[model samples]
Target: MPVHRVRFASVRSQRDPSAPAPSVDAREAAEERLLEALAEAAGADEPVTALAAILEDADPAELPLTGAGRTRAQWEILATLGARSLAAARVLEPHLDALSILAQADVPAPSGLLGVYASESGGVTLTATRLTKHDDGSDTWRLDGTKPWCSLAADCTSAVVTARRQDDGRPQAFLVDLRHPGVDVGEPAWPALGLRAVTTGPVAFDAVPAVEVGGPEWYLQRPGFAWGGIGVAACWFGGAVHAARTLRAQLHRRQARADEGRGTGPDQIGQAAYGRVDRLLRAAAVVLGAAADAVDAGELDHACGMVEADRVRGTVAQVCTEVLQTVGEATGPGPLTQDAGHAQMVADLQVYLRQHHGDRDDARLGAALLEDEHTGAEAWW
Candidate 1:
């Protein structure tokens, strides 16, 4: 599929490698260009070309892993992608997460985009059976059954699949090449308004050839799980940032209209809403940034890992939810109806942020705190 490539103006903002340090200003300037390019690309009738440009430039493979003392940079790269295009972020993030998963076991994934299809929803169950133990002490395996919520399953060249052992019924992670004859990419059943460019659905495996990535249950048990979750929260934060940016843009134009010629503008009546959106988004940013730092510090490696993930995801999701509502109300229907960029962003965020389980996750956090006896005054902090 053809995609709209970013214009030279956008790539020019990327700082020269040998010129100087990639200071905060340089990063922000480059990110600003990316955001603009994505906004321009979102309305294209092509494939994910703008996002592909980002991948080419960012080199997601070389990105630092979580808890690698540079986790902030990793999350920031994802956040920047999310800010302009969640559909792009939706497809790109899994590849990055899958790479991190492979890196955990020092297993090399097949070249090209990858997917992480572990969710076993819709009453489907994938089972893995050991096929043969090679003389090199490597065991070949096969996967059977269906995995659901597989975003870009058809597009990915390979995937890190999670399947239960046929004999012991224990979960295990396996690398499956999607091109296998036994692998079936289901019909595109994605019926959603957001992230539509990434057609997510179920995939069936019938004795698909595979290789294990790590030991049984290693996928979720790894520290990268929580780190990955936090990374998604950072995406949520970035999505909200876009919504806030939209709100700000709308208010400024109308305010200028009121100040000069056309007195019919809201006269900055929506400024308060913009203020709320700004404050909430900034707070969400701080929360995610701090969470990235915590992951790198190894503070959330094992102890209360899920709790921190839930907290950060929940906080960012809430901020995004409010931004959606606030921006919609503040801008009224003008932007939604007239501006394709603003409308597409709102719709995309609505679907993307739904990945968070909302109150269910909050209940889990409460239950975890109670069960762990983690009650204290400073704990409130």
Candidate 2:
């Protein structure tokens, strides 16, 4: 099917209440179309360039507009695209293309750069080092540290990474190719929670032949950091939106039956939970939308500094947990048996939520909102 047609059809699918909400397959098809359009425009067959364009152009709001706020449109776009990562990674097979695309967009193709590390001890310890040429034109450098919890490392060809130069002690970023002789990818080690399909493994590189990105001095200045955060945030946001929609459907379906006096629908707890989940997603949508707008406006510095990425991550985290709890209670074992979609969504959300767990590094968000006390701390309105 043509990409445009698929997208249109998927949109139409939304109208039928009984129809399953868009699945990972639909998300992947849409992403494939996007990748094709981007590849054609960059005039480069390399997947990195194409991936970069899509990441750069994507409207984050599409994924999961959280609130009924001013940014509804933007969140919708982000949630839609965010839902496709697993599917995208699956279809883009060989991992190089997807990894390269991620690196180009600065999304941290964890394993490719050096290696991805799982937080669990059973996971392999993967590391990447940076080598740089100093001002004296001599090849001298420093070695930075390792990052844990790399998602999608099992198949990435290379990763865009951050490291410190050993010689002079400066931060640097590199695109580490997984095919390099020294690169090693560990077996998948993630304990299932969500997003089980995407390989969350460890990659280890030992004194590998490395290529330097730009000049060593320009390393810390890379925008890839923000992009990486945004990518993960988008992916999580997508999962959350799917969860909300799925739960909402089940709730309403039950409610419909209850209305016919069959019992089960909108109980007080379910009603309250549904309302809370809706509000959470709505707020997430607004915040993520603003972040995307800031990116387009070239306000990346501000966006990154504020709770830009966190808004997406945090909101999704809360909503996914709440929705799953609510829907699971309302449907009981019925959803578990009859609706694989709900179960899958719950699993995916569990895994995706883990993305925000370990090294999210929210220090900046804490500092940014220190002065805005009231609005920042409150949960409602």
Candidate 3:
């Protein structure tokens, strides 16, 4: 199989051995250019294309977004972020501006992908923690837990984990080395419906020693940490778009064929079915765009308000399935022989859309709402 790779534009090298450390002005200038490029790439009109550019052109040391301007690097970050959260934004903003610099510097790959879980008596929470206390007055945390469904697990060298300090009840975040004895990458077993390319697998950690980044308070104060849900939505949106486009074109071609054929009657039912699928896809796109904007605006509640992210997360699968069904019906169940791309796209999307499931549904949103009620927060609009 041809693995997807990150590609980037080349720039001149500026590194000189024995040269003094770069001044603040130089660093800022470099960072600014990278961020601008990233922003341009990760926009509404061209996210998939933007992702391709970011993966191909990032310089980690210069941008701190990708571990390198490599697909593996960007994949690791995307996996670690799990596709949602303000933390992802925090990680995204700085590097989006200066990706080219990192692409040129040959930055190292990020640590690993199983560092986002918090070991709790209740369950495995996707919250950041602080467990280790290191020297220099800096706290080093330990992450000792298992994480299921990590993306690009084969490429990460380390992970940013969620754990707690033995001395305090507070949660903490740790950046742990994956090569350590405790970190064990597992087989890719996410046989769900979608994103098979993402390597959604399990990771086991036997008490991995870790370095704290921002302390417990800082890490906990970050976003909802449900970045995967967002990625689910993104993938879903992509699939939906693909399905809609494919079906629309198929309909047009079919309509033209029917008009030119010796058929006794018109395919009214087929036309209606195609029309409905197209409408759903159009609506999904609008909803998806709004949700993405809300997320970028640091408005989790608002984003969730548009329709729980989980619902939006499942939209791609639902929409794609509907489209496939419609296409199948329109073509009279001839296995959709002519629209192979549409079929493959639907297949690929189905593999990725399984991220939305039982516990991951809007029901969780309701539960979260109930939990908020205890804190005097309104549970509903």
**Candidate whose lDDT is highest:** 1
Best-to-worst order by TM-score is: 1, 2, 3
What is the C-alpha local distance difference test score of each model? 0.75, 0.49, 0.47
Q: Find the candidate with the highest TM-score and give its number.
A: 1
At residue 33, give the lDDT of candidate 2.
59
Each candidate structure's TM-score, on Cα atoms with residue i matched to residue i, is 0.85, 0.60, 0.57
Ranking by lDDT: 1, 2, 3
> Residue 361: error of model 1 in Å?
0.7
Give candidate 1 misplaced runs (Cα > 4 Å): 1-44, 49-61, 135-137, 264-268, 373-381
- Kindly list the per-residue Cα lDDT of model 1 for residues 1-381, writing each as its tens digit: 232221111211366778977456665455455555555565466546555444446544455566766677667766766776777667667877888888887797567777888887789999999989999778899998999888888778788999999989999999999999999999987777777788888898998999999888788888788788887777766677777778778777876887898866654558688778878876776777777766766677554678788888998898889989988888788888898767877888888788899999999888877767552211445
Candidate 2's residue-wise lDDT over 1-381, tens digit each? 222110101111136788777566665456455544533432344434344445445543222222212122223333454443333322222232233234444443343222322142443332334356569654433223344555556444455545555646555545566576665666777677455655665555666554455556444444434433554555466655555666677778887898899986677877777787777766655555555555545545533433555655565466567666766765578766777655665677665566565335455456545644642432223
Report the lDDT tens digits of candidate 3 across residue range 12-62.
234576899777577556654554454444433534334444644544455
